[model samples]
Target: MPTVALHHESIRLHTPLPTAFGEIRERDLLIFELTGADGVTGRGEAAPLTPYDGVPLDVCAEALAVYASILQSYDDDAPGVLMLDACREAADIPVALAAVDLALWDRAGRRAGRPVASLLTDEPLDAVPVNATIGAVDRQSAASAAAAARDAGYSCIKLKVGVGDDAGRVAAVRAAAGPQMLLRLDANGAWDVEQAVRAIEVLSPAGLEFVEEPVHGLQALRAVRERVAARVSMDETAEDMGALIAGGADAVCLKISRCGGIAGLLAQAALVRSGGAEVYVASTFDGPLGIAAGVHVAAALRVQAACGLATLEALDIDVPEALRVRGGMIRVPTGPGLGV
Candidate 1:
């Protein structure tokens, strides 16, 4: 059996990130460290932003306490069995379960002396393409940020829409990023079905890669996706796999915490692809450990779409330099475990 320990930390963003949900200026993250009997330790992060994902930090903490107690008595050598047992304990709290899943995977990879991606897949990518996120909503600010991202060697950019003047900001960003660059928008389910259709139709001419969560619920997403020529991707509305497979959108956005960690992410990715939709990884302003875990998963999958993992730069805290985005790509950490 392994011992589990928990730590809490608060981090502030360099600037407030404005989205359709609300403004995020800071984050309280929970880190879980799992140490095997052999004295090897693995790390994971649970970042819950109530305004973003609606999961509270205290609730995750309480779940972790329950998981910690269960892990203390359970003895399983097989990684799969260990994960299943751990997940059963924190099944209700996916965010907290994510921490345990991550730690287990990290410990497994470290024990095997391989990177987590290699442990998941036989062919892991050396680097994964990533997208720069622009938080600015106004035309001038959005255009300026888009231009900066272009100058910084980003080939893809994601902007938050359904906030204010969606058309103006989209047009501004398109012009600044040039016609060749891939441009995507996230509405955070802020609009109604009619509003989402209208917004997507109005913004399609600017060459949108996709519109994410334009409206809440699978049925509404399907309605909007059916009417518009532009592609639609589900984010917050993707929790229901049964409804998601019913063909609401062209793609789905997944996060580490939301998916319950790498193992769950792999399962969801398969489900998304089996339903004939694309799956891409994103972050919820997670700390370095969480972001690193996302990178490894994306690398193993070799997803075509640029992932939304280039978000660590938004935080004021220092992360591993290796996790930094370069040339519009994130290089997979090559060391054992998460390598960060």
Candidate 2:
């Protein structure tokens, strides 16, 4: 049997990470480690945004404690069996279960001396394109930031809207980014259906790649999608597989922390694809380890759209630089396990 260990830490960001929900200065991260009797170890991370993911930090900690207890009773010699049993036992706590499941996958990959990406798919990509996200700022600042991102070699840029003259902000950024750059707007479900329709109408001239979660609920989303020329992607509304399928979104955003682990992400990706929608891998502004996990999943899935993984620069600190983004693309780590 393997011994399971859980560790908690608070990581500070270089700047306040502001979104439509609120501003975040620090994040609570939970790291789970599973050690085999043979002494090899695997690591995973759980990052929950309270009131956002609807999972509190204390609840995640408690779930980890429960999972630790459940894993102690498992006598399975096969890592796959252990993973299955652990998932079944921790079914109620999906986020907590994700931490454990990710660690198990990492352990399995390490045991086989292959990277997790290779284990997940037959044709994994060597590099994946990533998008730079600009927080909501004043018109002048937004324009400057968008220009800087474009000059920095990022071909795709996602701007945080839904606050203080969103239409003005979008216009400024589009003007700065020019026509060739791929532009996206994430409102984080801040508008009513009427407001969304009006905003989309005003901003559509900017030529957006997609507008994410303009309003809450599937019905509102469908309404806005019908009225707007720009494509709509769902974030908060598509938190689970069922909501994602029901939302009828043009695209679905998958966050590993919110959607369980790699396995959970893959399942939802397949479901969204089956329903004729594109799947995008996104982040919760997690630490390096969690971001690395997302990168591997994006590579294995061969995600064609620009992913939201180029966010480590927003943090003041991160795990030793295990992954790097160049020319708006991230090179997947090829080492054993997560390659971190």
Candidate 3:
């Protein structure tokens, strides 16, 4: 699986998915074709479960344009290697490179007659917990969305924040979802350290599981961690192992697309989760391709906290899923590669 080709998709979503951290306007799909010497093609996507993580749709096309030449050198059997090389050269935007990398893996999976999960050397399908994410614009919306998730059989729910109504919004979601559900929030770097502290205090009494990036920047993040009630996890801030270690993050948020590939994301998970930092394998509102990648990584690891995998409830279509959640426990995708 050495060579590569590109494709695109237009997906219509229900509405803009919102949370304390960020919002998704819509998610376009991307395809990567990894061709073998025999001319088989494998397809994969790189979009996050949600459209946050700072990856604008236009940036992906730009990434393809810039790295077109270097990617052409590799043959089909080397889809993984070809993608790795591109990632090394185009380090600034791993999300774009992820499309190529996963597509290569998908192609290689086809060549080997296995799913993406089977091709991963590090994974054999470990079980994990999954939380359903509900995207709503305000507390009223949050509350309504939470009820829908509860009805859908999700045990835990995560809401987005970053705007001013943080406390009331959480209250609305919590009240609607009821007390039995575990709640999480994502702020999308909307507050300063001081404001983050005040905001968390307002909501923590309701029993939050954790908070994702209440403030922006690495330094400000650590400062807010000192002040807030909910434990802080790094999402947009921790792109790689170096950043994860350097940022002093208590929890490392692993999104497959943002990490560039499942293989690399698994590597970072080993370093961060094994070292006692909280590791959550989640997605960025990516298409099914990206969701499968994150599911593979999370499915392979032993994660305690329920993941943000619930974000997929909002996607227009489904990708490969490694596991499903029931009563809060996440199931591991059972198969050769990540095609579960």
lDDT of each: 0.87, 0.84, 0.69
**Per-residue lDDT for 258-292 in model 3, tens only?**
77777678778877865568888887666666766
Cα lDDT of model 1 by residue, 1-340, tens digit: 8788999999999989888889999988899998878888888888887887778888889888887887777654745556556556555677787888888878888888999999989998899899999888689999999999998899999999878888899999999999989999999999999988888888999998999899989889999998999999999988865855777889999999998889889989898898999989998988988888999999999987999999888888776888988889999998889887
Clash count of each predicted structure = 0, 1, 33
For model 1, the run of ten residues with the poorest summed lDDT = 78-87
lDDT of 2 by residue, 169-244 (tens): 8889989988899999999998999999998888888998999899978888999998888999988888643776
Which candidate has the top score in lDDT? 1
In model 1, what are the clashing residue pairs, if there are any? none
- Model 3 worst lDDT window (10 residues): 319-328
Best by TM-score: 1
Worst 10 residues of 2 by lDDT: 75-84
TM-scores, all candidates, are 0.97, 0.95, 0.84
Checking candidate 2 for backbone clashes, the offending pairs are 14-316
Candidate 2 TM-score, C-alpha based = 0.95
